[model samples]
Target: MGRHDFFSKYAPRPGRLRFAVSRVAVLALVIIVLGWIAISILIAPPPSNEPLATVPLESVPTSSQSAKGSASPSGPRVTVHVVGAVKKPGVYELPEGSRITDAVKSAGGLAEDAHPELVNLAAKLIDGQQIILPGDSTQSQNPNLPAPSNNAKISINTADAQTLQELPGIGPALAERIIDFRTENGPFSSVEELDAVSGIGPAMLEKLADLVVP
Candidate 1:
């Protein structure tokens, strides 16, 4: 082969060079578009949920409300008539587990003439129980009072507030004051010390002197 013919056969033409350059340009453009899409997916911000995440705070209960919620219900009650030598003789309604003494207390405790020894105070009381005092059921000169008897005197130092009310002209208020005085000043040494209690006049003291003992 001649030198010029060999050179023409081996070297590329302008048309083929133009076609290869066009293909390379199209491939580079596709690569750049794919790289941009990948970068956008990796670095884009997360979806917002501001309204969904927000919530209102709940209100807390107060101490009084909590106490009401935790409280247990009450039990059944009973009614009884306390007639006789009580301070306030009448009918009263009380809860279950009440005793005869409790019914007596509801009627303002026993009166001056009430004989505590005659009734069983520790006994349980039922509905509609009639609590008649020692001498109350009978007809007499002082039927509402205690039955007369030659009995031992009441002990002043050991007597409770209700027992103290048995003294002549003594009521619940005076009995409580006497108990308070006794607690503050110690036990009474003599009957004359009755005068030391508030609301106790000389006449009252003289009346109590013969009734109580230390």
Candidate 2:
């Protein structure tokens, strides 16, 4: 067979050729769009099941709170009654471990007529204690009186502060306390009544048992 004849018989029609080429172009476009969508879905991250992270809240300390933390600690306190010769004699509150000197100062110190030498200022103070200062009246009246003899039994009711000081363990301060106690509560009925006096305890009473009389 001739070449031209073979070509003519095998070649497709123009209308059919155009239709086939359009169909192939449309199919290629659809495939390209579908491939792009699939690639985007695979490359993207998976959806998270956990909740979103939240910001934390911060607080600043207040002025009062800071002051409370920085303040110094305080110790226990004692209450006492001060009377006679001080500028302001009344009940007062003082810190624990305070001494007789501190109590006197708290009461505005000694008066002009106060005999400061008649008390033991260095003695430690106790709660609910009463301090009595010997005024000019008590001192001037018995300034020249002599202390009783060591072997004699002093009368607690009638003896002055100087005589009371002769007892064992009795200082000027304690002597004044004895005088004030008897003056306010009346003459003691028994030697045991000495226990009621401030600063006089069982030990002091025992020491004075043989040396003093009610």
Candidate 3:
């Protein structure tokens, strides 16, 4: 008999029906196992996100503002006169912590004949100080005068008109006025007393401190 005929013939029998039922059950179990495997593959967790890039909001630092708000003290500033043998011999305004070298640089550097050994370049400057550069021949003649003394100090109380002229912003006329004011008034109680004189104000006095005598 043909296979189709054989299967049809056996399809209605109790034993054949039992065998067909068992085969159907086996197919259903296999289908269920395959669906469960597909579901497990689809639902697996994705890879971690640890290596992504992040950006910052601030700008990089530069030389201009290396240290902001770290300014030096803001009290009175000293002014000094650097005359003779300097490139730009004039009055220079300096802070309290300035050195003789700083004043020389501000005066446009020393002249060719300026004896570098004469003055202590590292010496700290004071208010109302006068720094005179000697001539080449004079420096050679007087080696002692080159370096100021350890006790080298300015006497503001007794400075003459010529010495007072060495102050910054004080020309011959202003120098004369300073002397006259001191003569009329008693010895200055404070350096600020110079502002009491006519034509000499806070601005001018501030610039005169490093180079002034009395």
Score each candidate by Cα lDDT.
0.73, 0.75, 0.65
lDDT, model 3, position 157: 43
How well is each residue in 140-172 modelled by candidate 2, as lDDT tens digits? 554332222335456575555666787888899
Show where candidate 2 strays beyond 4 Å: 1-72, 137-214
After superposing candidate 1 on the true structure, give the runs of residues whose Cα lies further than 4 Å from its correct spot. 1-60, 135-214
Instruction: Residues 124-201, candidate 1: write the lDDT tens digits.
Output: 555655566544443174443334445645555545567778889889999888777766776565677888888999
The 10 consecutive residues of candidate 2 with the worst lDDT sum are 143-152
> Model 1's lDDT to the true fold?
0.73
Score candidate 2 by TM-score against the native. Answer: 0.40
lDDT score of residue 146 within candidate 1: 35
Question: What stretches of model 3 exceed 4 Å from their correct place?
Answer: 1-75, 137-214
Highest-TM-score candidate: 2
Each prediction's RMSD to truth: 13.2, 12.2, 12.5
TM-score (all chains, Cα) for each model: 0.37, 0.40, 0.33
lDDT of 2 at 191: 79
Residue pairs in collision within model 2: none
lDDT of 3 by residue, 1-214 (tens): 8999999876688887899999999999999999999999999998897897778769766666766645565877887777656788778888887877888899888888765443445655656666665447545665423332233334344454555565566678876676667556644544667888888888887776544322
Residue 14 CA displacement from its true place in model 2, Å = 34
Better of 2 and 3 by TM-score: 2
Question: What clash count does candidate 1 reach?
Answer: 1
